[model samples]
Target: MSSTPVRPATSRPGAARAAGWVAPLCWVAVLLDGFDLVVVGTVIPTLTQPEEFALTGTGATAVITIGLVGMMVGALTIGTLTDLVGRRKALIGAVAAFSLLTLLCAFAPNALVFGILRFLAGLGLGGCLPTAIAMVNEFTRSGRSGRATTTIMTGYHVGAVATAALAIVVIPSLGWRWMFVIGAAPALVLVPLMLARLPESASYLLAAGRRAEAEDVARRHGLELESPPDRAAARSGGAGAGGAAATVRSLFTDGHARNTLAIGVTSFMGLLLVYGLNNWLPTIMREAGYELGRSLAFLLVLNVGAVVGLLVAGAFADRVGSRLAGMIWFASGAVFLALLSVRLPTAGLYLMCFLTGCFVFSAQVLVYAFTSANNPPHVRATALGWSAGAGRIGAIVGPVITGALVTAGIAFPWGFYVFAVVGALGAVALSVTRAVRPAG
Candidate 1:
């Protein structure tokens, strides 16, 4: 039995308090997702040591690609499932599943075993991200959804930074396996908190006709039920369909077809830049004459920029619209990425890395913010899932392409060129989506 009374939403303070609780829970979930997401990259340097995984560049890329393949499948499938089931259930299930699998990865006997475990862990990893993003957007105030989404996503960079810091201290002495051990720790801590405290999406509850529960949840959390005016049409043609196929079909049938395609292409390009650089940046720098420690430090600096970028981009997006913000941010990211092709002094390199991180990581996130802002509640989860799923294709390709280049010993200036091009393409895709809106 519980003793906490439901606070009346009579004042803005009450609403802010309720939001405080909900937002942090969502933040922790995404933080764990981010931590696990970057763990592979953090450990790749150690994994290549002769005493460690002894993986070739191609083999390492295969592991990353395989994991992303699983993530793509999970993002497409489980994202729709989040819409059908409740967001609460999907989020908890994903965190728990990934945590357990990642713990098992510590004991993998060979490269084959490690790659398989990473792939399995990735299913949960991919599933949790879009769900977390959707949850934050749904719970926050309408106009603030973009900021809420980006704010909650800061947890991802925090998690990535934490992983990188730990790697700096732990990987040298504790071995790369310790990183997996640490990555799995969030599950033990976060799962119980989520199950006991996290509230279900009021929008989902209302759509499913659980009026009493939805009302109670809304009251307790100081959130209004997001029953869009177009509920009838959304119910008939979009998310209300019990089948994933029907839901997916609805994305293209409505005026959403063009927007959907644009989001997909944009996500593909955005994620390619994100994953490609994050996964290969350290190694690329190391190959280009930087020491291993400094290379790892660059990853940390990059994500620090990501944290700043999320706050800046989110605030700007709320004022100017995500479409315009994304265009500007992606363009900025392109210029910084292209600048990396020139080898500068250590201070200059660090500045560029930080600036690149500021724009590059949050560029894709603004695309997500745009998707959430544009879609109605009924199809929001599915739309975000598909967009992220499309991005996962870029995720799959990014590492593989970078890995191939690394194997061929041509990953330096060429990798930066490819990433810069991808960033430009993302900006272009977002520009095209400005003319299309979802059909009601």
Candidate 2:
């Protein structure tokens, strides 16, 4: 099919305005992802209480792990599907799957059923981020992908902040299931809007040997299509084992292996810090003797810092490169996380929590930004998929460890220390990768 039609690209301002829908639509999808993922953490306290879900520490951790397992699978599998089915279809399918699954979560009869629903939801959750990143990168003007990634990622923090705020009000009154109900509501609004407004990736079209479609897309977005569509490569790079296998092989060929391995390691460390904190920050804060409200509010404050970090880090990444910005953010994150070990006044604690979120969350995103910026255009989608999938090891482990710590009653001081160490490791990982890029 020809690319989604737009006004002729002759007028610069007109073409720019016409293409404005890309970032915001992707932002909405990312926002929903942030909301869905953060909701589990926001309601963890309620779920574990004696009179409610009565979930044990181990069971709670298992729930999180199960979900992450699905996420890992989704990232690895559906990411390949995007290359085959087109970005819009894959993205919309992912959002639809997760949204519907999230709705079912409210009807889950017990923890096991709820966990299953969450697991399925994780499939959608896991697939959305990288696909969104790839699409956003493709949609932006040349040399601006890093900035676009960071800006679109701000939707994630905004969703986190909004959902956490909602939790403060809803958990006590309507109970936790209602939170899932609200989380599912986005599909109704977003899917139609996405279908109406979201354009398929021109890069995907070009790569797939759809020159006419690619050229149409390029014209619509004021982009130039380079090289006729590579149909042979596209067919050979089809999805499933045949395609994914070759793409994986390509990564290891032509000196890409070193960089690939380095990013994998960095992604693992960075995600450990991200998923760990996202899953346990409230619980950790609460166990530190903060009031429950304050603990939940810390989630809000932390995500507020995340939004700020996105803005600051995005600009810096655009100028100095995502690798250096990631290193700086990770180092700063380590220091702030370590400081959480000390009990402080309310103001001091809030400030630290905000700053920790600012650095820790953005640090991982910068890793993603770096991955998006550095890889070969042909293999970029696959590389991102694999990097994110590899990182899910940390996503799976982080919550489990934090859960065990919380169960052991050491989540406050010790948890922060552990996170501090992970943050440092992430920084080092990113630093190591910087020296291992493709030899020109």
lDDT of 1 at 320: 84
- Report the number of clashing residue pairs per model: 0, 0
- Evaluate all candidate structures by whole-model CA lDDT and list the values in order: 0.80, 0.79
Candidate 2: Cα lDDT at 8: 26
Candidate 2 overall lDDT versus native: 0.79
Worst 10 residues of 1 by lDDT: 1-10
> In candidate 2, what are the lDDT values of residues 1-440, reduced to their tens digit?
11121122445666566567778888988898679667887777788988778999778877767888888988877776776667889899999999999999889878999999988998988888888888888767655666888888999888877888898899899999899999999889889988987887776776565658877776776665544533444553365677767766777776677778878887887888888887777778789887744355666788889888888898898888888999999999999999998988889988998898889988888888888777644466677787889899888788778988989999989999999988888888788764333110
Point out where model 1 deviates above 4 Å: 1-16, 45-54, 226-241, 286-294, 407-410, 435-440
| Residue pairs with backbone atoms closer than 3 Å in model 1 (clashes) | none
Please, what are the lDDT tens digits per residue for candidate 1 over residues 95-185?
Answer: 8998899999999988899999998988988888788888887766656766888898899889888877888788889888888888888
Error of 1 at 120 (Å): 1.3
